[model samples]
Target chain A: MNTKSDILIIDDDKDMVETVGTVLEMHGYAVRKAYNGKDGLSQIEKKIPDLIVLDVMMSTDTEGFDVAYKLKNHELHRYIPILMMTSFPKYMAEKGVEKFQHILGENWPVTEFLEKPVDPDDLIAFIKELLDEKNP
Target chain B: MDQGHQLIKDQLFFRKELMERIDWFILLRWIAVALGLTGTWTAYFIGYPIAIWPISTILLFCAFYNALFFFTWRHYRLFRSDDIEYYIIFAHIQVSLDFLSLFAIIFFTGGFFSPILLFIFFHILLTGILLSPASCYTYSVVVLAAMGIMILLHITQILPPRPPLFQNITLPSSGSLFDILSLYAIFSVTIIVTAYLITSLKVSLRTKGRELLRVSKELDASIIKLKALYGMVKEMHTCTDLRTLTDSATKNAAIIMGVKACSIKLLDDQRRKLDFVSAYGLSEDYTKKGPIDIGKSPVNLRIVKGDRFSIGCIDEKEAFQYPEDIEKENISSLICLPLRVEKMIIGVFCIYSGTPAFFSSEDVDFFSLMADLTAIGIENIRNQENKAWFVKKASHQLRAPLNAAFSMLDLLEKGYHGPVDPRQKEILLRCKARIKLLGEMVGDLLKIGIKRANMKMSALFDVDVKKKLREVATFYETRATEKNIRFQLQIDESVPTIRTDPQLLDHIFSNLISNAIKYTPAGGSVSVQLSMDNKKYIVFDISDTGIGIPDSDLSNIFTEFYRSENAKECTEQGTGLGLVIVKEALDGLNGSITVESRIGKGARFTSRFPVPV
Candidate 1:
């Protein structure tokens, strides 16, 4: 297994992007940054990243959910792992997840949800766990 | 002031028509009185008979007074259409008395020598024109009855019998009894024909007037309805409550289309279900069945486009199918309008009629306009609610990260996380300061959201005014002393207890005191006073000899995200939500606040809370 996995960071906040990007980079993961959902979708099109870190609130609050829905519906991207990120309470995150399920049905592509200002060590561990999952 | 003046003007206009009718009647009565008095005086001066003058004058006076009284009473009860009947009857009575007086004068004054008879005849004619047929007949019958009684009395020798004025000039031997009877018959036939003609003409005129009035009234009602619709359209533009706007629009649509019921169902974000938020003319039991899930229902097949459900009507041959429940409720006709906001269909507005083919293209157009307005209002409310929810949730989530950062910084500062080098210590201090700032920002955001959402504090209890003031003053005393500022609390012992959220009260006081300390110079003083006003309100005045607010900024100090220029220059750490929170909290308690300030001298804030009885 590779020590560093390619991680895609999608967020509108410059401070958040810089801080989280640096944290993951220091932990030996190749990190990519996208300023918005549009750029993040294009980045996914260019190459299928190992894990996608998406912000629920970008240009719009539901942009992240919409992108995730589109990805889950696409045949090629349906199997890719996606992680939702938000600076909202756990209940709000759950609501977003439920809404996503409502849109794409029970079979969704989301692997996990992370709160903003993520702990560097915990993020790395979550990524490793997703990578270790059996791919069907 | 303008509104007050307009109200008075409207009241005056309401009385205008009634006033005009009364004026005409009053003038006529006055004229009659003057004429009657003049005639009686002339008769007396002419030596025409003292007894006749007094009787005629008395009758004339009575008639004038009665006419005036009747007109006034009718005017007062004009709102009752039934009172018109009484008015017509009274007018007939006046005319009848006038005719009897005219006949008596003619019979007594040399057999038609006096011209008053002609005046009385024309007056009766006018009365017939103004009144209904029944009243005219009543007046003519009374006149005939009076004449018959007079003739009978004369014939019976109960009264002096007077001959025809031309009897002296004619030879009675040449005139036969047949000639005399024929002349009497001619006069009787003429009077009856004249009365019939006048009465029938009046009846025709009254019927036409009544029909015209009915048409006019219907026109006025339709105009009022149109104006109300215009007002609703203008109101919809400014309305921020989705339920209220939808309810008004649906109800108005139902009325305009003359339908049995109307409803507005908003699709959830996922578009899998519809929630009925407002409805009119629908049974309560039906509304309580909860929102309908579109995917699982058979009715969806009729409305859905492919896999997407249609929000409009459903018909077999009409490209849409009507729901069975709608038909069961006797709603055969319907028009369903989809409400789209930002290109996403968010809701449907529907109108249901009991008659088949009741809704037409014109109705559909009007309903579309209504739906457009409803959609805009719903969008505004949804956006506002979402924004409030996001802010609240974001602030709550921020607390955890902020706490973690603060704790970690605290551990580093206390040397608990191993020995820190000078450079590391400097970084740790900076981190601590930034984290503190972030915590304050989060608190400010939360406060603003709570104020905007009108969130009420959970804890409420009876708080002694004096005790509360003392505690607040004592808590801030240390900070005041540290700045070398004199702090004092003056509590009126007579002030009573108040029901309030103590924690919120504490926050209010703390913010005010902190602001006072922060703005006050080293030697300035701050004082807290509590007293009862004439209204029995517990007035709390916080006066600080700190830099006062400018007059221009005083009015906006309590607005969310608003900061006084002076305050902004003094501190950049504030979130500008403290005063907004204070204002909202006071409003929830049915209290009020006023501020007085003199720049560079001092400031005083007075809050008045109604003392619980």
Candidate 2:
């Protein structure tokens, strides 16, 4: 059995999924990839990932939201933390609290939110923080 | 308006009521004539000591006169029902004839015991209702004179007198001469007293009726004006551009005041001039009088400095800055009101009248209310326009992304996200399902960017241009009414329906018509004509008698947000995106539009769409 943490990168953008997979691979974490919400759910059914990287707009604008919801509520994968990404930073901003609640609702289905065109260092740091929180 | 025109309408209603009462009087006269004839016949058949021949002759005479009155009444009702004055004269003649006939019957029958003597009392009351108070008093005098003549005939034993109605019956107590004379005296006094009371009562009642009518008319006028004002402001809020909104608004203000003309002049502090932004009811010759320099005009300068000034007589030159323009426009009296938003004086609102000193203090006060609301509306619109781009720009950035994903190819992007470089990171960040859409959006979609962008590219359906133009025409017609402008829409039977996006067509028609209305001054006309046959196109001609486009500005009007200098002089605000949007939408539909105009004359935009095969 593999001892390394398994990370799932699910996104509609091919480039986004490949780059995330490559980065995670470089960081020494085992990674799997899915290009859509349906494929991501099917991949989780095969073997649940320790962490998930999801995009807001996919095949549909809200498809990423649907995938995150499914993973968080799953019996086996419920503990996996999701990092949600969005191209619209205004809606994702923590300082834009009213907008956040209006678009995303009071209970965010994911562990945290991140803006698009995200820096790699910031993305890794956030992922490590979420993984540690889950593990601890 | 004080609803001055409706006062004439109220009088017509009052006269109709009066005509009904006259008809009732005619019916009663017929009843009296029937009664007289039958009563006379019955008395003669019963072998009373009365002369049947003379009594029958008198009754027939009364019937003949009544027939004449009946004919007159019928003729008036059918042919000249609105002849109020004629009816009054006819009523007087009938009343006098009835009085003479009744008095004749009393004289022929027993002087103190005539059967129809009591009808004189009804005559007194009828006179009060149908005639003026002075005429009612005069009728009472005629009554007394007739009575005096009868007394003289009784004393002198003139030709002959018919026996009393009850002379053949044996009465236990007959009336003595003293008692009869005393009763006649009492009858005369009561007739005069009744006439006095009825005259006073009818005067007060008619006055109350007139007051009620005036008050109700004023109320109706107020409600309609208020509703129109509310509808205008609400519509103004929905309008994104300034020129069209203010043009429609100025038209409304002129209508609200019931004046011949009204103009809103916006102040340019930098230029120290007041330029006419929008006007309703002003002659195009006057609107073309150019701007009023504050340094040159004392009255307008005072208004700009927040003082309300007026010229009771434009020719007097007391308050008028430009008498020559006033004379040229044939303007008489005018009120110049300061438009203010808070403490700052923004512009002047003017109302012109053909009559000298036409605007009462009340008129000025009411106009001030409209001015205050308009100032607030302008300020609010300016602020909203400034903030409108934020939401629009946001939606434009959010394109309906394409569906795709490539986990490996995206990873190859330099500094490619997951944990890599920012540029490559950005490229790698998009999900496979959305990256293709993002690429095209950043790629081809932006080539037709911003102003001339296509309508929500997905929602295309067959548009009914004819029906849509009718609805839009009906809406602008009311605004036209306020400006005394004639608006018309005509579609040829051969016009064809083209298959295209209804929204884009709507934008094309509305933007063109709205511009027509905005440029057209008061007393001008705007029209939309549609035609199509075996031609290459379904054509629409939107024409207006307005300030026409200058040759220089004409070339640039279709550029995004390009407003003409003359248009700017007429209105302080305009989005200038209307023609651009129309041009783009037409282009999308593979249609074309061309403008024909002469400065200070008018313009016509002829648009054509290729027939869809």
Candidate 3:
């Protein structure tokens, strides 16, 4: 099997990043990692990935969204689809943040949102669909 | 301030009425001048005659006076209607001068025999209608006396007697003394009688006007107090701190009482002293007079024991509380009310004014109301803080570590960590299930916190009810099929769209459906029906053939952290908070929910929302 499609994961939770990364690597995919928005941008600068799985909240409340917004707008990395994840649908609902789907349109930056603790099977399926859409 | 505004409004209304009356008087004066000028010119041209020169000169003088009267009316208009008192006084003086001019014209014509004497009666009637009866009666007496003096002067030859213009016509100079006496007697009786009748009618009118003004002032004062109460209630909603609440309460109390200053003194932790917590319209020195010792301050001690204290003057300075401070602040009157939550006295709300006897029994009643509201607000804040602290430290801290453990377990279950034996795998599956249950409990607790902290219905958006029902049904479709249960939906076409938080509505339906499927045995069915209930409500009924709630637990099912014994046994993963969250979410929608259940049969939950949502 050709594990050629590269996926970059940016999350502040160390254990979540490790588990999610190991799952993707085991599923025949090349996985790269960054802890926060600043390092994530630098990782993309070094080499662009085929897909990105980003966290909605990291060092700050919306740091991961900021990184995804930047990458989606940049000409070089605009083609890469983003899968946004957060453990805070409950937390952010109380904090009065509008839902991610309402903030951005379907044709724009982030492709989808998944609530955590990130299920390994769902994450792989989302990555495969995004990659297949890009190739098709 | 309200009273002042109302009084100004009353003045404007009175001024408008007076302006209309003045317009009529101005028109009458102009008409009299026109007629007087025509009669004088007619006599001079026809020679069929009267005393043309004197009558002409007097009429010209009358015209000049009336022109001045019009200018005075114009000047009155320049003054704001707020200065209506000045306008009333001006009307009195102007009408009196009008009576004087009428007397002068009658004197020039033929005294009692002059036809112009009748016009003086019209002026008397106008005065009685427009001016105070005292002024009107004064004008009446003046006109009668002036005419009587003129007739006497003419008959006794003290003033010049004019020649009769016609040969046949008899003048006052030609009449006998007896005829003149009878005329004088007749004019006196008629003028005095007219004045009596008109002034009598005006007496009841003046009394009623005074009564109306008094009632308006009382109403204005009461309205101010009501508004102050409303403002206090609104301010209480936004304040979470005791000091902030007390400060705002005292300020509003001062407004309601119309006092110079107000202060709140709370019993300190030991309950032995009254500390000044907040004060409005008070000097720094007064507020800083230090806390009151229950042993030393007699007045405060009495208030602390729940007795209201009112003092009109500070004569016995030593006996009163804060003697030197009260004298220095120039406080002439004082009212102290005990702020009580139920029977327990919490603090004292006091009002101080520089005017003696400023506060009455009515003021006491208002101050007591203010104190009661303040106490309730304080109690609510205290309770909210306690609940928030308990939820925060207990649930949130417990959830963080639980979340980390769940992520690790997910990795292990997926075989990302290592290989596992069949026995170890069984144990892992049980652990995962228990962990999921723990996580759900934490989530439910956090949901309660969110509901309490910020579940404002004002932030709701329009939601498609049919679409939401479909989404919730689809979300639970797999779970329903796993249990071999029939999941059904009966939605009416007339079930209108509702305004609510979409996530909350999803939570409500999800909890109800999830509980239904979880409790029901295999082959049992669950159904959701949405329809319009009459004209005012949209109703949702969720029913299932399930191990229904025991009748004893029905009342408490909607309370937080309550689960039936059978429910717990059937599903060890149940959080027991589903119905609590559902009830809170319904409260946010301003809706009502009811449930019917039997122990072995089933349960049906019916929720109704008001239309126009």
Candidate 4:
């Protein structure tokens, strides 16, 4: 049964999502892309992927975090792994109090956080590790 | 010291006023002596058979004392301003002499029923004003006792009783010793009652004055706090020019403080001069007195170095540089307070009054608070000013383009563009590296400009030091692994927790650790060691086996965008702002960092922060 691991990439930046999706597809994984949280949620509803690759580097700091939190809290998709692309965990520890209140947690809703400008090989290896752990 | 100085000033005022009162007292005694002589002569001329020898002798005695006091006061002032106790004693002596002379006049003219007896009330009032209540009551007691003695002597016939000077002085027309004693007793009671009334009235009046002062000071403080709050809320919506904002604030300061004028003078660092920036309630001619050179005016120089001072009178001394000019402008007194945001002095705020010694100690305290608020307000407005706002917004806008370009170059450099010439590939690699550095620099500028303003007020929290360090160390470990560098992290088991802002601690560790990883060559070691120093502080030692800083460049490493010669050659990847941000973040935590390096042997940065007391 020629079944490939399905992956969904969600990011506000269309080019970033396309490039990252192209790299992931090159690694023999079937890929899907969504530009915002709404499209990402609906894409998951159509077909749950093996792993969800999300980008927390967005126009607003909390939008990405809100998506991760919703996915983590969902009854059906709570177990699905989310690989969050964010510079925030290191770039700025916490911004203002009001902005950081929801983002301030030792246990982030995502399975792992990857810094931006991530190396292509490192990206493949991290996704492989998350997919293997979920399927194996 | 200020309290003592205020005391001396008050005493100076009291002494001058008392000296004038003494001059008036001497003049009045001479007038009384003249009246006595004329009254005695008239009694004789009208066939009253008055004794001339004793009355003339008494008059001459009064005149002698009057001359003595008058000449002494005119030639040599006995008491100085600080001699407040001495002035009290002088007043007592003068009052006592008057009482003795009055007693003599009353005894000679008539015993208790004499018309001159009313003079005792005036002396009692003076005593109440000059001396404390206890001393005033003592003087009244002495006067009454002297009258009793005269009556006693007359009754015993030891001193002959003279006829009443004023015939039919009272309705009783009584000259008997018992009537005199009864009248004398009543007179003594009246004197004591008058003294008690005057002293009590004086005390209650003083208490009310003190109450009013306290209420006024409290009211002033409330207004200052409210003004600061209102300014903060209003400034958020409107980005006003610095001069326009400060000019309005200065104008309000004058109205609130009830001063003649208020002004601000900012320190011009390059010129080493103070420039008058904004002034309210001052004439244009006065404001155009030109910038005051710090070298020429030691007062302003000290103020720029954080000093608060005041000049009581512009004509009195050279406490300010343009004292003469200010005097011509009808500004008599001025208070110069350093407007300090944190420990740095931004400028001087002056409250000018047309009256001498206008600012009280309370005024200094209130203005000092206002100056702090003003300094902070100026910083706030300056932060949102065109330059700062542009840097913040422009850097943010620059970051997006840089990142997009970088992402595209990163994809191409990763061979996603497929087969290309070796030379072309080298050029693309260089472009990627250059773009990466540019991106990091853009990020660093954002950190310095916007992040700093947001994190100005450090949010302190009790941090598990081991946890925060491990988080930062683990993050850098991966980066070090990618660069083929050996990274080691050692945390002492006995490492105590710290009360500091988590972001600041994270910022320091992240920047310094990243630099260590970025600078070191492949196969070199980078290590982070956390330990306690004598239980006073927790120390973080971040060492790298990399190209060390030159001896000459070590001092300038923390300056903004300052990169060492070796660092720039080894890596064109640095933003040259990592160490600067590190040092500043460390300083915000009340921590210090020191670096020691050898040419080829690597550098170790040791940072120490105080433990929670």
DockQ per candidate: 0.07, 0.10, 0.27, 0.18
- Comparing only chain B with the true structure, the TM-scores of all models are 0.54, 0.56, 0.57, 0.40
Stretches of candidate 2 above 4 Å error? A1-136, B1-14, B33-57, B60-78, B113-115, B166-189, B227-231, B234-238, B267-275, B280-332, B338-346, B388-613
The candidates' interface RMSDs, in order, read 6.3, 6.2, 2.7, 3.0
TM-score of chain A, model number 1: 0.87
- Residue A25 error, candidate 4, Å: 2.2
Two-way DockQ contest, 2 vs 3, winner: 3
Model 1 ranges off by over 4 Å: A1-136, B1-96, B109-120, B126-131, B138-263, B270-273, B280-284, B292-375, B386-430, B442-613
Q: What is the TM-score of each candidate against the true structure?
A: 0.49, 0.48, 0.54, 0.45
lDDT of 3 by residue, B411-529 (tens): 78667789877888788778888987887887787777768776231244588887888888888878999989999998888877776677677778889889889899999999999
Ranking by TM-score: 3, 1, 2, 4
* Clashes within 3 Å, all models in order: 8, 20, 0, 0
Sort the candidates on DockQ, descending order: 3, 4, 2, 1
Between prediction 1 and prediction 4, the one with superior lDDT is 4
Which of the predicted structures, 1 or 2, would earn the higher TM-score when compared with the native? Answer: 1
lDDT of 4: 0.77
What candidate 4 gets wrong by more than 4 Å, as runs, is A42-50, A57-61, A69-80, A87-109, B1-397, B450-458, B470-493, B514-529, B542-545
Instruction: DockQ for candidate 3, please give it.
Output: 0.27
TM-score of predicted structure 3? 0.54
The best candidate in terms of lDDT? 3
Residue-wise C-alpha lDDT for candidate 1, range B50-153, written one tens digit per residue: 44554466657657666666655666644444334454555555555556556766555433223343554455465666565666666666655555555445
lDDT of 4 by residue, B106-196 (tens): 7777666567779889889888876778999999988878877876776676776665566545423336656776877789889999999
lDDT, candidates in the order shown: 0.67, 0.73, 0.78, 0.77
**Candidate 2 TM-score, C-alpha based:** 0.48
